[model samples]
Target: MSASDWQKSSYCGEGESCIHIAHAAVDHTVRLTESGDPAGVILSATPHAFAALLDAVKENHA
Candidate 1:
């Protein structure tokens, strides 16, 4: 993704090593990376997989 495509997580504060996500340039996948390590490994997930991950996280909190 380009510089303008990646969006920071709204829940993060300034200077935090948070995660960022961007829509894939040419596919139906989400791209994830750390703000502090932009050039590091980029994890990709389908829409369904991403939703399942969020569901699991929410369930853990509940």
Candidate 2:
């Protein structure tokens, strides 16, 4: 997937510590930085796994 195609999360805005995510077909790739560096480390995960992570965060915060 192209780095330019990565979509920033709606919750992230003008923040330096925010993470970006890009959809590669049915999988999701997360980027630690938005410097547009080709060497950026990308972590891939399934939609279900990502959703579960979000749920865990919400539960933990609650």
Candidate 3:
């Protein structure tokens, strides 16, 4: 996927440590990457897995 297809998270600050996410329609998977190193490792996960991860993070913080 192209860089333009990736969206920055709303929770991100004006800093290099921002997170970017993208959806791959072909594979129906979610992609995640660190904005500070766009060319670095990109992680792919199923929609369900991604949602679970978000839920876990939210619960942990709460």
Flag the better candidate by lDDT, 2 or 3: 3
Candidate 2 clashing pairs, residues 3+ apart or interchain: none
Number of clashing residue pairs in every model? 0, 0, 0
Residue 47 of model 2 has an lDDT of 70
What C-alpha lDDT, on a 0 to 100 scale, does residue 26 get in candidate 1? 89
Q: Model 3 over residues 1-62: C-alpha lDDT tens digits? A: 77778888899988857789888899999889887444653788999999999999999999
Deviating ranges (above 4 Å) for candidate 3? 36-41
lDDT of each: 0.78, 0.61, 0.83
Per-residue accuracy of model 2 over 1-62 as CA lDDT, tens digit each:
57786666667767544566766664444433453443564566677777788899899999
TM-score of each: 0.82, 0.60, 0.83
Could you tell me how far off, in angstroms, the CA of residue 52 lies in candidate 2 after the best superposition? 0.6
lDDT of 2 at 29: 46
Output the worst ten-in-a-row residue range by lDDT, candidate 2: 29-38
